[model samples]
Target chain A: MSTIVKVGMADLKVVEYPDALTTLGLGSCVGICLYDSTTRVTGMAHIMLPSSKAIRKNENVAKFADTAITELIQIMESKGAKKTRFIAKIAGGAQMFAFSSQNDSMKIGERNAEAVRAILKELNIPIKADDTGGNFGRTIEFYSESGKLLIKTAGKGIKEI
Target chain B: MGIEFDRMNNDIIIDVLREIGNIGAGNAATSLAKMIDKKIDMKVPVVKLVDFDEVPEMLGGPENIVCGIFFKLEGDITGSIMFVLDQKSAINLVDLLMPRDNAEFDEFTISALKEIGNILSGSYIASLSGLTNLQIKISVPALAIDMAGAILSVPAIHFGQMSDNVLIIQNEFIEVLEAKSVDGYFFLIPDLDSYEVLLGSLGVTL
Candidate 1:
């Protein structure tokens, strides 16, 4: 059995064979889990924001949802995971802040979620299942061997994805 | 009609707010640093004093805003203070607080934001109280959808026509492991009686 590889926010980890990739405490942020069931290759990233432009250019680029997703995909593909065969499962994107204004930038949580969907669609990678959006937070675990996804939400029960 | 006070120029207000923001943010940074056993470096806060209509532009968009309320006291004087941070900053903060865990960014992280808010609000208020030698109580931070409207409405209950005067300060937080950007705003709403008291305290003759 492969050991579980845990990834933190702004970080990513990839492993081959029987290993489980996991990330926890997703709030307004997005966690993208990519798994190649045939090869048992799994990768996960906990991205904090949707865009990198809002932050300093030289900063941690992996922390942003957009760059992180692309990087995760490239890294996984480099490890012999095929892009066409990879299935994506995502979680997080809570409206942690309740104050609504007329502006769009502040709705970062929503924007992050929207951006993830848009990016995934453009890549032609089908999102097999997703748990996103709300006032609460979530934790996600992805199993590479069987492509089993376990999701735990705040004040809510665990669910299989 | 409520009496209109002379508007403070943006540059002057911003400068004053930047100084105050540094002090308040410094308190928060110290608290977090002690908790995580890491050194935090924060840039000098950027302050902006703008009309209510201009807040949207300054903040960059309309979404949920989280606020922490605190009271500051200085030598028998008391002031109500509030801190506001953007959603992105909130997420980044949660990530920094719980770095070892492999949790996705979700409600757990948002809940984590409240914890940071509590620390920041509590510590800053405590610092202000310590400096001022007065007692200050803070209300439980309420996460609301419309922050500006909520703040204006709350002050109206205690004071009439009080939303017009607001002070805002923005800052960035940086540490060796990560960096997060955030902003805070202080709204000064005084009732007719409190207004008189404030003016009196400032030694202004009505």
Candidate 2:
């Protein structure tokens, strides 16, 4: 039986081939899955906020886009995964409620998606596929062997990338 | 992050907070019971300071599909409030309130749910205000039917930014005749700076 590592909100994990990493209940949070197919190494992050700089508390690298992406890359590289060979598949970042005025905090889903995209661009990781921006929540599982991201929503079944 | 229950060793303070939950939830339950004319039984409310990861499990699980009604709390304390109901409870509530032949969460059903949310939240806040003497304003409620995790993330990110622990007040509603139970959670995620105001208004020493 393959071991499945569970990543919680504001957390991240890295796994090798034949193993999987999963995160549950991503609302406005974005789940970034990076895979280096050459080494069959996968890293997934469940990021809660767009940027760590805005938070005054001690930084949780796994909780923010800017820092979480950086930490995921470092961990993957340490585990024999080449940064240049890394490709990304992202999901979640949903606007779960409708509001009359779209304030900065209220648009966090869009902001999180944008931040992830920008950070991936800076890191030169090409995004292979993405399913984002809706009024729903998602639970995601990333398979390291095939580098497939399974995105599960409530009514909308499952989609693989 | 769980509540610092160890540090909060004062029984009087804990009792005061629990009383707040009792009054607020009691008013909401009474209004809900009056709306449907069905005897609604409510368990003693539970007040907790919980971590974000454990929140979805409170309703069921991260993947459990639920109907969440969300609104921002303004005035004395800035935060968010949500009323979460499962699909069965939502449909049953619509049946009781609207008494319609078809209960498919059509436009009418959705509207009825929102109205119920509005009434419940209004009564909840009103009771708190009456006890604390602090004016609380509630924004128009928005309803979403999806995974519990998705619906709750909005408030967690909005008001729970400063601390990992969130103060949650939860209660259950049950049907008297059928003995059917529906879990309803009331989350009042106050801003980080509002705790002092809340405790001070309640005459609890910080």
Candidate 3:
């Protein structure tokens, strides 16, 4: 039986085949899913911030995109998954609110998306699909069986990537 | 955990924080009363420091749809404030002023909700700064109608930069005319150092 494992905000998990990983209600936060189709091993990270450099109290490595991605990769590799064989699907990172007077924090969604992309490129992991940077929140479920990532929205229809 | 809790667990500090909530939310309820032309009573609910995971649960759940209005706090303090209402309460509150027939919130109802949040929250901040004699200003309020978890993520991420735990102060308003009530929440988050300033101004040591 396939079970969906829930990932909380600033948390991540890796699953074996037939198991799935899910994270709920990602607003400006980004959910990054990495998968290996051959082994059907998958991992998901719900990142709240773009980087971890600014935070002194950041003991949770899953809280930042730059740190979370690397940690997720290592954990997946430890479970017999190859980093070179991994592909990524990403969602969330929406500008939830629009203000005329823009500030650095207001553009966090875009920065998170950009940071994830840069990190993935630096690590040489190709992105298969991405749904980021809009005025919406998302809940994502990633299945290890088929490397399918399902993205659900409040008003928008469900989509698979 | 050690240092943050040390500052919060002090009896005098807790009493002082509760006093701030009383005065701040009281003024907010009064402003809400004037806007709706009804008798409003303030109900102080949960006021404490909570972990990030527990925050959305306080709003019913992560997936519960809510209308949240956010303002960035500046000047003597740095942080953000959010005014949240469940979908039903938002519709009911707007109906009191604009009297909409449709159940769904359109542009007019949405704008009205934002204005209400702006004014109501303005009073809360004014009272806080007035009490502490701190120079506090707020940015233009931003409104979002989305899942409680999604809308709350803005504040969580902003405050989460410091620690996983942040202070939460909730308020409930009762309308005496129809014996009906509306549930509104006020989240007051001050930056780490600013908390020291706030308490110091109020004659407390951190």
Candidate 4:
């Protein structure tokens, strides 16, 4: 039995067993998980920022959403996980900002979620299920053994990830 | 409109920064209080204005530090502010928001820190707008390492350093389980023309 592995914001976790990897509290930040059901390999990343342009190169590159997702895919493939079999599941992109005016440009939560969706689409990886968008935060867990996902949000009840 | 600090001396600036900290931290504390249903006692906020060179010394070696930068736009002009929090304070703050039964640092704790950063930055900008009566808009908070030399070396990286005004506010938050101290630095980096405009808005003469 693989124990629960918790990942923080701006961090990444790669495990051979999908049962071990889990991520939580996705607000404006994004939680992306790459898993291969055949090989039972899994990788998760919690990205706080969208891009790494402003950050230094020597810094931890896995903290950004774009770079982290790419890195996670590479790591999963290295563990004998096939790209064709890999599927992506994402969560946590809430419009947490309570601005009076609704400006499209200012919707970072929506933008982040959209960015992940677009990137996954470009990579040809299908997103199996996603629980994104709203005014509340979320906690997500992934099980590599069964490729099972668990999701929990305040006042929203718990569901399969 | 270069602000000649006659009325806003170093001491006065510190006082103002303290007041700002009180208001900003108070807002965050209220939210945390509501989340955990526990009251927290925050120390009197300490404020200082230091040169760019002095930033490293104040942060005490700069290891395990996290920085968040946000740009605030007021009409045509924009100003940037950075918030720096130490590792211990960051973890403690998260623990306060989401107390775990296991007493271990978990994913929930890290997420809590990010959320805390979000709340602090949001409340700080909102309080600033309320205080200055300026329609300020803030970007989402982005996290960074608090390497002092690296942060100050790149002068024009995020915000230009045309103006020599920097405000540092130190706050201590005390709860029943843990106590933590964190610093919030506000750098008013404005171009020559924008600096003048900002000063004029603040009722300071050039």
DockQ of each: 0.03, 0.63, 0.65, 0.02
Q: What is the lDDT of candidate 3?
A: 0.84
Chain A accuracy as TM-score for every candidate: 0.90, 0.97, 0.98, 0.90
Residue B3, candidate 3: alpha-carbon lDDT: 26
Reference-based lDDT, residue A38, model 3: 84
| Cα-based RMSD of candidate 1 | 15.8
Report the poorest 10 consecutive residues by lDDT, candidate 3 chain A. Answer: A99-108
Work out how many backbone clashes candidate 1 has.
35
Question: Between prediction 1 and prediction 2, which has the larger DockQ?
Answer: 2
Best candidate, TM-score: 3
Report the Cα lDDT for residue B58, model 3.
Answer: 81
Q: For candidate 4, lDDT tens digit of each residue in A13-123?
A: 888762577654455667888888889888888765566663443155555667788888888888899888989888876654344545543365676688888888989
Candidate 3, A21-68: lDDT as tens digits: 998888999999999998888999999898899777678899999889
Estimate how well candidate 4 is docked, as a DockQ score: 0.02
**CAPRI quality level assigned to candidate 2 from its DockQ score:** medium
Given candidate 4, what's the lDDT at residue A53? 60
Which segments of candidate 2 are over 4 A away from where they belong? Answer: A1-3, B1-17, B98-107
Candidate 3 off by > 4 Å: B1-16, B98-103, B191-193
Residue B197 lDDT, candidate 2, scale 0-100: 74
Candidate 2: tens digits of C-alpha lDDT, residues B150-170: 887876675446656555778
Which pairs of residues collide in candidate 4?
Answer: A18-A143, A18-A144, A19-A144, A149-A161, B1-B196
Q: Measured with DockQ on alpha carbons, how good is candidate 1?
A: 0.03
Report how far off residue A3 is in candidate 1 (Å): 1.8
